[model samples]
Target: MKTKYQITTFLIALTLLFNSLQLKATNTIIEPDSDKDKLIIYILRNILTRSHYVVKDINDDFSEYVYNEFINGLDPNKRYFTQDDLKEFSKYKYKIDDQLLNEDISFYNLVYSRFQSKIKNAKSYYGGLLAQSFNFRKNENIDVDYEKMPFAKNENELIDYWRKQLKLSTLARIQSKTEKQNAALEKDPKTKVKSFKELEKESRLEVLKSMDELYYRIEELENDDWFSTFLNSVVGAFDPHSTYMPANIKERFDQDMSGKLEGIGARLVQKGVFTHVYELVSGGPAWKQGELEPEDIILEVAQGNEEPLDIVGMRLDDAIKFIKGKKGTEVRLTVKKKLDGSTKVISIIRDVVELEETFVKSSIVEKDGKKFGVIDLPKFYISFDDENYRDSAKDMEQEIERLKGEGVTGLIIDLRNNGGGSLKTAIEISGLFIDKGPIVQVKYRDQDPIIKEDVDPKVQWDGSVVLLVNEFSASASEIFAAAMQDYGRAVVMGGNQTYGKGTVQSVLPINQFTKFDEDLGAIKMTIQKFYRINGGTTQIEGVYSDIAMPNKYSYMKFGERDLEGALPWDKVKRANYNQTNSYQNFADVISNSKKRIAENKKFNLINEYAKWLKENQDDTVFSLNYKSFAEEKSNQEKEVEKFDTVFDYTSNLTFTSPTYELPSLKEDPVLADKRVAWHKSLSQDIYISEALNVLSELKMNNTYNAIVKH
Candidate 1:
């Protein structure tokens, strides 16, 4: 006897499975060999050298960089290799360039083989150490800062290093388990808590289990993955953004950009050895079937009539590859329910999973009797393959019109953590605030700068505009912010500076240049650089905010300036453009905001938190002794507790959806809940409260000027 949910799911899955078999497969597989490898290297080098913004001669220096970079990428912790291994590999320090030109991959093979051999030895080293009991009372510490440390001097020294690492990990786990046990005892007075010795033994066993799983997964790595890393190292020497994508990874990237995937439409994350359901996509196959829910642990996955494959202990990526298939395909998942832990096989038909969260959305915020809009644009998303696809520019325009219908007096475009996307969308979106102007200037290698202009004369919202940004706001985000600042269209506010990614990359497929059946993944090469309308390039020096705000990430190095081989900041001739002069008291308002921030207690707390975070980041080396370690953690926790009020600050504001979205509350409860949660977050955001104050000041100044003119 099957439940209604199970019957519905199976019927859908069976119907889709038949349809999937009838459709023609588009992808063809090719084996990696010397001929294909030579073609890839040849095509990549030729394209990059000719089209890259900054072309470098493949000489001895470049070869040395590639050698060090590849080695460091594989074993960044100074593990897996000894001093003797480094010495032997030093011979190829300046020969990699010549070998690449000759289509030679012998160097990669040599290094990869050595890494595999060393990793095998390391497995035995950790196994032997974990077998014995660790002394937590030992007065010893391991310097976990691998960047400053050298490679192992000998095999004996390497084994000792592994021993300390394993011991430190095991000790941390033991302390964590003991604390949980103590908490459980406190909660239930009659319950008997496990002793510290018993907890320690259990923690050690758990750590050993996790390590065994990790080592097994490492051993299962196919040659294609390793070769992809090596090829990435070769192209990465040119720039950080330039790289090679394996065929499978390329397919996923394409799906991500399009915001669609053919799968059961459930977000999964690995916890320990099991894959748990995080969220089900709205209106997706699994969501419609309705049996799958959040926190359900998936034990096995089967395709069509195949035997279910146990996914426990399998890597997340590998398991996902098995679960996701072409649309109309049938997949069955053996899921263990979260509440009762009862297992059931739920069949689901694969459909296109549309990621709705990636799109632009707006909320009407009312503060101090004045309604304003906050447009949270996550990315400048657009699909190049689909010309009719919905993009950020179009979505933003629609949101603005909807907010206008709700009678919003001001607007705030929040681009925090928005690592940008489509360049065309950024240009079009910038034009919405101002009448018309040049948005950005692009310069290719030895070519004239191409000025991208928004020639439209229609100004959607010229009143009280504010742009919010943070360190993660990059590329197209920087372009939009910089355009607004240069034109004096909006008051840009947030962290010290945005992420400075001004270079443009074009993904060129290698198969297009060769006759090979292999779908050799594309080379995403940086082809051009972009500059602000005012002539400054946001290459390494990103756009600065008009009103600077302090946060926990203020002291961290996350911008393009922190990346190696990043392009330098340079200025070109300024484009002919007129400023909007939107704000009448821009200078005075900025000064007043600065004064208010200086006096604000919450801002002061943020500054203190930033300093504390920096200090803790710098102090990486930790005491291995349990007592000292406990004391250090306790003191840190006490210090953080002092700033508890920082998160407690909430504004006396209300947020609501527009009239058009109101009916959806009754139609779709899930969407209604999401909107409710989003609204609640906005009402509590301290930064947004301050932004409203800024908008009020702008509006008041405009009114004052109008009275004086009359």
Candidate 2:
């Protein structure tokens, strides 16, 4: 007789044996062909079925998932598609799996065609609807719970739906204009206030212009773009993390992972018809030039001394094409400043802009005369193209050394909103805290779990540590936090739990698999699942906080468990590791923190605010009548005022950069301004204040008395 592990393995093998036979049958149904779309489907189907962590069979259930995902992707708000279109599209609801096997694109083609037609029809509907004045005085309400909303029955009903949406938009604008006019008149008795009729007409024109811009962007999408959307729908059925990326998207994804981009060093966002500068990268060329600022609208773009090309009403992507150029190239932008509504031409030399926010940043704070260090890691970033390039682990180690030089007693590693990056860096970072131990266990399909250990014996920071995390802390972040928590190395503090993403994905180039000349893009496929060293998987049940804190997302459904089709949480054999037993009074420290939080008025208010947010999120119906809408808006503002003190709360601690960074801050005023804003925000962060308190209470064991020895 076999042992339990062997028996379980044998059963899994037997199930896969049968599934392999079905896969073979499906493989015989279609051979790789010249058609790119069908070829992509073939490649994705094979890769997902064979290599994915969870083996989901291509059956009616999978087909239904793809169908719903595609339809929802096209018309999420149930705006464009009518019930008749859905009915026609539902014919292939259970046939998608068969179509995939047969290398057929009939369903996708049909849906895409119908969606295009609906978009065209919607343009006319919005234009006609916004041209006429909306009778906001009519007593009516609109339910915005679009997920459960039924599609319109006919063309007339569809037009009526558009009318309601446009009416809601126009009503909001009218209300805002009326309030501003009233305030102007109140401020100055001689102020010329526009009449209700004039404001209403102005609001309609604004709404109409917004709709036109939206339709123009929609019309700019090529057939390949829509096809990519359909392909993503198919791959997404396997898991939420698995996705298909076209060539352009893959390029941007690479840039994001590398935390570098070649441009004017300003982030842009399209509003109405113009692209506005959202932010300037600190220390970048634009920031150095000191001409471009956030909220400045780029009206036109010119290369060097060439004639300016008007970019107003241009597609944001098209505008970016003109704005971004090779390094050392000059690009002049005609800008409308947000400060004084003044038009000015600013020229700047483009260069490689490093996104400073993507890396590790540390601040020193003094609490009761004991200096504590806070490291805010946005992501576990790494440059995959070059091994010698900067990574989070190296930066973290250097920052720890600097803080140690500063004689800081305790350290807080903030991983809040850090959707994790490199797994290598996470393991390396974990090693900085512990001498040597297993960090995480990776398990792929049909293979024994492999334990990834930190073989390094040197501990970087042998002191009291506090790890801060929120619901957005995921993947590599969760792994590092879990390792520290398991080893009793740090006090994990944050929301109830983390983002609960335990799976690993590898981006594979589609062109590599085939002899194709064109760039076929890539696929990010989930290949493995990670488990904590203690044998518990951080799949659905993320690493729970040792000391839970109240946050705005506290009562929200934001973790992986809240998502559909997430992998089930399971365990494997525990990896061999030793607990550091570093904290002497860990239990007492947690108890004291809990007691203080229980009586804290601000925390209680935050909890109440979280509940109120949940209530508002659940309420989707709104009155469309002008009088009721205004009253509801007034009531909301009044109610929101009760929570206004949340922003006013500040800690007594003072945060500053390390001595090494002071020289750079003095050189770059933009960088100095950014640090000032960050320090200000940290001073107002109640969570960090609590973390510092916990850090103060923690007492290290004599066995690990490195910090005390220093």
Give the 10-residue window scoring lowest on summed lDDT in candidate 2: 1-10
Candidate 2 residue-wise lDDT, 515-561, digit = tens:
55678788887777889999999998889999999887788767789
My TM-score estimates for the predictions, one after another, are: 0.82, 0.83
lDDT tens per residue, model 1, 1-710 = 00011112313432353233223112222223446676677667766666677878999999998898788767766668889999999889899999988778778878999988987887788788788788878888888767777889998988878877777767776766667677888899887877767777776776676677666876887666677777888888889878787776555555543343338877676543468885565446786677887668897788987856767656667888888998889999988765333456799999776567667888887767788998889778886558898988999998999889889888999998677878889999998877777999988787788999998867777568889998878899999999999988788999999989889776655555555677888777776789999999989889999999987678866678988888889999999998766677888888888899899989999888877767765666777888887787678779879877765677778888878878878999877877887788788888888888897777434643343233
Poorly placed runs, candidate 1 (over 4 Å): 1-34, 258-316, 319-354, 699-710
| Residue 166 C-alpha lDDT in model 2 | 83
Clashing pairs in 2: none
lDDT of 2 at 461: 91
| Per-model CA lDDT versus the true structure | 0.77, 0.81
Scored by TM-score, the top model is 2
